[model samples]
Target: MLRLPTFQLHEPASLKEACALFAEHGAAAKILAGGTDLLPNLKHEIYDVDHVISLAKLPGITGFEMQGHDLVIGALTPLAQVATNPNIQKHAPALAQAASLVAGPQHRQMGTLGGNVMLDTRCQWINQSYFWREALGFCLKKDGTVCHVVEGGKKCVAAASNDTAPALMTLGASLTFVSATGTREIPIEDLWVADGINNKSARPGEILTEIRLPLRDHTHHGAYGKLRERGSIDFPLLGCAVRIDLDDADCVRDAAVSLVALQARPLLIKGVDALLQGLKLGSTELDQAIEAVAQLAHKKCKPLDNIPGDKDYRRRMVPVYVRRTLRAALDGTGPVHHI
Candidate 1:
């Protein structure tokens, strides 16, 4: 039975208090949201923290509602609530689907939307018992100098395992963060960086507060697809999220495709809107457009041999999953494949 290290726990009654505590403790403190991810890492001794700041008591960070034309979701909102909320289902079905597909019912009940969004990068070698990793001399993501997946590699290549990030990115979401200094907002895409060791762009002492999504029009449609080793309790091997806006004639006016678990960060395939602009669904050009998007994804994605399944095989499936998700988004149907 793995045991967590000794630490001082702080229960902050409000966001301001939490920020103050974090500012005082600095890097020695770790934020505790759902504990689904952080607790396991603590037990495994993957990282050490002298202070554990709990956000359970923080106000204004536990629910969702519409603020004028945008949907404002508190960072501490539970994944289960996000998955089942009527507003999320109607306006951002891809986000709802992604949240629902995270881990299982119990995890969804405990995991927060912010926790899922801030999920750490994962690799097969590093996600093991302390003794197991100690025997292997550790990896760069933890306390080691070298990355086991890449010989003599200078940087970690752990894959991004978050589900909702891609979905939110597809919907043009922005994140609000607070710190001791002040608060700032940026597009969700800006929250990620490509490096695995230090993936998120959030600064020290910053707390992710909320997610804001733009209002969706009737012509907007979106879908999410994930490939995992199991139907539940498994991180995605490859995840795809797609959104398309269509005109009266069903021609695609704009499109976006975001993929996760393909790299160290969720990637928004570039030039998708340009490639898909003015293309009508069910037209001969549709297949070509899909293929073009798939090719672009293939170019951007460079999965390392750090996780389950053959790296080459996973790369090959990117196009397959992207194509399926795009079709589902356009047809207003769930993605055909989930494996």
Candidate 2:
């Protein structure tokens, strides 16, 4: 059996206390939200962490509310709740669909949205038993310098497997972070950098406390599509999220598309608005435009052999999922997946 390394655990009663503990521990400390992700990495000795600061008791980080045109969600809110919340489902259907498809019932019950947002990039070579990785001389993501996915590669290319990130990006979400120093907010799209070894930009000791999404106008329709090895309990091989805003006459006014599980960060396809704008659903032009946008997404996204599935196969499926997800958004029938 794989055993976790010994570590000091700190349960901070307040968000302030949690930030303080993190500040004190610095790089030696890791934050514990749901433990669905962090605990497995801990058992694998991924970080050599010496301290774990738990946010279980941290106040003001576990609820949802609406303030004017914003849907404010506490970072600690469970994925299960995010999936089923009426407010989220109605206002941000893509996010709700993405949350519902994460892992399985048990994982969703425990994993928090913040944990998913802060999910570490994953690679086939790195997320293995210590002995397995050690025998293979380790990869660049952890102990060694070599990158298995790219020959003589200088940097890691671990895939970002978060389902909610792309959906959040499509909805124009923002995140609030707190630290001993102060509090700051940034657009969800700005939270990620291209580096796969550690994909997030949240400074060390900064705690993500809240997620805020703008109230989408009634003209907005969205969906999330996932490609995985199974119907549930598996990370996506490829994930697509789409948003289509329609005019009063049911013609596309604007559109956005984002794809994940490809590289270090989720990809937001550009020029989608130009392609789909002013096209009414059920028209030949709209159909052709969706195909065109999918082709554009395929061109921009290049899958590597960093995660599960053949990179070529995953790359080929990009346009398929993107087209289907966009169709689902237009039909208000999201979360396209193979059961």
Candidate 3:
């Protein structure tokens, strides 16, 4: 039954208390929000801990307001709220679409937007427990020093499993982080680091308090596409999010494209901006842009053999998803609408 080891559970009423608890417990303390990922890992003894600090009692951050043209989403907001929020759908369609595709209804109800964004990802070899890992001689994400997904590699090979990161990037979002020391904000791209062990830039005592999304005008269009093994309840093998803003004359003003599950963090293709320059995102133009985006992403990402999909298949589908998602965005077909 993979029973979790006994541990002290601390429920803090405020962010201050949560930070203090984390500091007190140090590396021995684990933070708990939606137990969607942490609980299973605990049950398998992936990492031993003495304390579980709960962030449930803390008041959930909500309310979408305009700071000039920017929209702010509270970090503690639930996935269900983000998925169904009409304000989000109207302002940032790509983000709303990604929120809707995260897991199923039950998970959406219990899981939170902050938890989803902060969640640590997995590789096929790294997700197994101590016994399975011991048999495999361990991986860099766990106890081993070498990357099992890539033989003789020194770095961990866990994939970026977040559903929201790519979408938020397309919307030009930034994250607000609060810690025992102070508070600061940085672009979403900056929050993720290159190393899997520290993929998140948040310190041990830090908390992600908010996500700031730049509001899209009526001229802007965006979409999100997820490729998974099942109809639902499976994490993405490959995913893409794209946003484009056009002038009144239908000329491209700006473009953002991000791909997920390909590496330790979401891969942003800045080349899309150059490819989309001064042209409308029609089928022909989008095709060329997708090719450019795919090539850039392929160069940046080195997908491991650990996950389910073939490397060649994932590589081929990068352009496919890029083309399809961009087309859907241009057509104003929201993720929910396409489903």
Q: How accurate is candidate 2 locally (lDDT)?
A: 0.94
Q: Would you list the C-alpha lDDT of every candidate in the order shown?
A: 0.89, 0.94, 0.80
Worst 10 residues of 3 by lDDT: 330-339
Q: Write the per-residue lDDT of candidate 1 for residues 42-159, one digit (tens) a residue.
A: 8888777899999988888889978999999999999999999989888998899899888888999999999999998889988898999999898899989998888999888888
Off by over 4 Å in 2: none
Q: Please, what are the lDDT tens digits per residue for candidate 3 over residues 1-339?
A: 678889999999988888888878888988887788788889767777999988888875654666887888888788888988998888888888888888888887777777888878768887777788898787777677888777688887678888888998888789988777788888888888877765888778777878998777788888899988776777788878888899898888888889888878888886788877688656576567667766776666566675779988887777777767877888887552224
lDDT for model 3 comes to 0.80
The list of candidate 3 runs beyond 4 A from truth reads 281-287, 294-301, 334-339
Residue pairs in clash, model 1:
none
Compare the candidates by TM-score and give the number of the best one: 2
- Over the stretch 87-181, how does candidate 2's per-residue lDDT look in tens digits? 89988999999999999999999999999999999999988989999998888999999999999999889989999999999999999999999
Q: Is candidate 1 or candidate 2 better by lDDT?
A: 2
TM-score of 3: 0.93
